[model samples]
Target: MTQELSPCIRTVNVMRYVTPLREGGSMPAIVEADDDFMYVVKFRGAGQGIKALIAELIGGEIARALGLKIPEIVFANLDASLGRTEPDEEIQDLLKASVGLNLAVHYLSRAITYDPTVTTIEPLLASKVVWLDCLLTNVDRTARNTNMLMWNKELWLIDHGACLYFHHNWTNWEEQSKRPFVQVKDHVLLPQASELAAVDALFKPILTEERIRAIVGLVPSEWLTFNVENETAEERREVYIQFLLTRIANSAIFLNEAQHARQSLI
Candidate 1:
């Protein structure tokens, strides 16, 4: 499939702290920005920390590269004094901890959560979503928690912090890249993803090494502070790019795994 070049992620300054979204463990909140727009901001201080933000940035951009609909992601700046007026101790602590930079997505007002039982996705689209989650090894997109929303009659992917799970440990990343996504069986869209082979062939070439590098480059150096291997921010970026390139080369491994899983479901 032909695709356009992905643009750099925009930066926005947080102006107001709206209500907190309690759905996910991260405690992402609805906040107004200086741009006069609302965003669902994911703080760096949450339990999962910056690694989750990195995954959110990388995975969401990868999906965008594949022409998937996703909300606009931005780097939000939070002032140190912003949390001082908060009455709730929990939110106060969270804001105090996330005082510098955070990740946020443009709020999709009036969007409804995607319900598989009530709405059906076509085979090609379903296959693409499944293929994406598999490639990212994303563990969050299951029937129990479909990280999708229906806005303006279009499907928008969201909450990809659970993706790229290998980074949490950062061991044998190359080996992990070639492993099969056994979780495919639980993917909410797997039953309709009948075109895995076709999707695999069409999608593999789209994630070129240079394109992958560009996506990984979006990560800021500040968030790469956690050193598991005494590696610099640039080194960490290379690791992510290499992992994805290796995974794309070994697409057949996971594709076969997904196809087999689909057989059992059908």
Candidate 2:
């Protein structure tokens, strides 16, 4: 797949990527695109890294396809024409136009340590996060709660590069928790549960089993993996995939989708 991402988008010197982000940037990386803007970049990683990117791309698209409020983003490729280390003059100009030099982002985080604190993030807002994860089958966010960002009253969840129903082999979920997310039921999204369910209601339509299977099939091939002529590695990968799809498709609680559909054929 060709990963060249320049389509009338304002480009920037991604190499000049800043660090520590004045403590309030969306992510810690030297951003190549503005928050509201959309640009593409070649995802950096191989094997699992590539799989993670594919999962992210698919999950992000699926979330948006479900008519949910997703953080604006796109996949783009870095232009190597610029010297590997040289500043991307064009990118810098784009950044200059996109943001104010004196501008500071009000980071929505309460603390920085990896404490057991669940964060000051209100329970209600946290429900939307649960909804997002349920639909995406994100396993990264845990009760210990190290994967969220709160800005103002709005809660933005991140680190979904690890979701999309592939945390472990999904072949057998019968033993897993099938109980409803009662804890978060009264948390926040409950008020809009019907509406939220409707938003993701069409997922079954958009991501039919066949379609989901195609995505899963592309996992190993499309992901980044070093030269693995070893048969054992290939066998392990196959086993993992077999179980992965089995569990993800059959599980109901985490991968919950409304029974309603514009077209039915999940």
**Candidate topping lDDT:** 1
RMSD of every prediction: 1.2, 11.4
Model 1 misplaced regions, further than 4 Å: 1-3, 227-229
Top-scoring candidate (TM-score): 1
- Candidate 2 C-alpha error for residue 59, in Å: 2.1
Evaluate residue 122 in candidate 1 and report its C-alpha lDDT on the 0 to 100 scale: 97
For each candidate, what TM-score against the reference? 0.97, 0.45
lDDT of each: 0.92, 0.39
> Taking the tens digit of each residue's C-alpha lDDT, what string does model 1 give over 108-166?
99999999999999999999999999999999998899999999999999999999999
Model 1: pairs clashing at backbone N, Cα or C within 3 Å: none
